[model samples]
Target: MNQLDQLKKYSTVVADTGNVELIKKFSTQDATTNPSLILNAIKLPKYKNLLLKSIEYAKKKNINLKETVSLASNKISVDIGTKILNFIPGRVSTEVDSRLSFNKNLCIFHAKEIIRMYEENGIKRNRILIKLASTWESIQAAKELEKENINCNLTLLFSFAQAKACAQSGVFLISPFVGRIYDWHINKYNLDSINIENDPGVKSVKKIFNFYKKYSYKTIIMAASFRNINQILELSGCDYLTISPTLLSELKSNFNKIDKKLNFTIKNKTYKNKITEEEFRFEHNEDIMATEKLSEGIRQFGYDQKKIEDIIIKNI
Candidate 1:
């Protein structure tokens, strides 16, 4: 069996992209999307019409495209998300606005709006995971949303405290970024003085994985931001993993004999962590890499969102 096939014994593999057309070929269990992926997809010829269609539909209703294309793309995101769920038989993660990460009320409001849009289109709330950043406000907002039975996927996680905090909040899923971990190591150590086997990103996720498994945390850990297959293979048998399409394809093609390396059935283990709000704040503040990446990730997403909005305003 391919590495992807082998990893399936324990871990669920999710396709992390906005393009739904090729999702089935990957045999991904679920799909995830954010403004950046959606923005990238809009540029593709196949997806352009969808963006324009949403814009045109809004134009007909006199809804300002700039303000409304987000609504439109969100609707589009749900449509694609629901469609991919059909192919994979799992939950689809649709992200709320990254700009709203720090705005608790707005995050809750938009999360509900996205869920409502999905529901109207015949998708159920259970099969949808609202993606939020790992900010304190977003975490609080997610906890409130959970009270309403809305499952959330907290993304852009880096620190152990973030994972611990999210688990304590009882979120359905938490995606601790792997590749971004590598990014920090590369930037910090200049990439030349590092050992790939002992790479910081790899060690980071493994620690969280062991902690969650040892403690039996309810929040599933989906390792995200993988730069290569080595990272994925190293972190096999994780709760779930959101891999880019290219890596998924590459993994499928390279079936180098693999086995489930992560032992999930082990008895509960102890991780010296108390993932509270203040703990999360202090931990995040102390980790320069996490702090930098959080700001940089948010800014990049915010910039892309603005760029997409700008495009809609000029064209529609």
Candidate 2:
């Protein structure tokens, strides 16, 4: 079997895209999307008609063009999310506004709104995970949502403290970004290529995996934003992995023998290297790499979101 199939034997593989076509082709177990991916998809020629239809849909409802655009933009995301969930036979993550990353009540309200939209279209809550950032406020937001039994995916994790915080808060899942970590280290050291093993990104997930497995935390770890197939291979036994289309295609072609990189049964499990949340914040703050990357990540996604919103309004 190819490595993708083999990896599935150990961990769930998720498509990391907003493109419904790719999700259908790979048939990933779950799928993830952010503002960037959605913005990227709208540029495709095939989606032009979708934009026009959204405008028309707005007109018939006596809604202004802007409202039509807003409705259509949301519809495109959910429409594709629904498709991915269908093909994958599992959950599909749809994100809330990143600007509300710090407001727990607003996050909960928006999450409920998104869920209501999904349910209105006949999509069940069990198959949808509301994606939120890992800010302290968002963590609190997730805690509340979990009580309502609405699952969540904590994105933009960079430090172990963030991981522990999410687990302690009792979130359903967390996506530790792998590629972004590697990027930080590469740019820090001015390295050209990053190895699958010993890569900082790989190490971050390993740290979280070992911690979660050791404590038997109910919150799942799904490594995201991988830069290469090797990193994906290194994380073969994670709870789940969200991979981009290029790496998925590469993994699809490679039929290498696989071995479990990290698992729950290992002895001598505790790493005394742990630190306090304040310490983690200071450490991450001191590490120019993590700080810069975190800011860049939020900016990049926020930028795309604004761009998409602009296009929607422009047509209105």
lDDT of 1: 0.81
How well is each residue in 69-157 modelled by candidate 1, as lDDT tens digits? 66765665666676677787888888887998999999999899889878877888999999999999998899999999999999999
TM-score, cand. 1: 0.92
Cα lDDT tens digits for candidate 2, 176-252: 99899888787778999776657988898998888887876789999998877888888888999998999888888
- Model 1 ranges with Cα > 4 A deviation: 56-69, 266-275
At residue 236, candidate 1 shows an lDDT of: 82
Q: lDDT per model, in order?
A: 0.81, 0.81
Whole-model lDDT, candidate 2?
0.81
Give one clash count per candidate, in the order shown. 2, 0
Q: How many backbone clashes does candidate 1 have?
A: 2
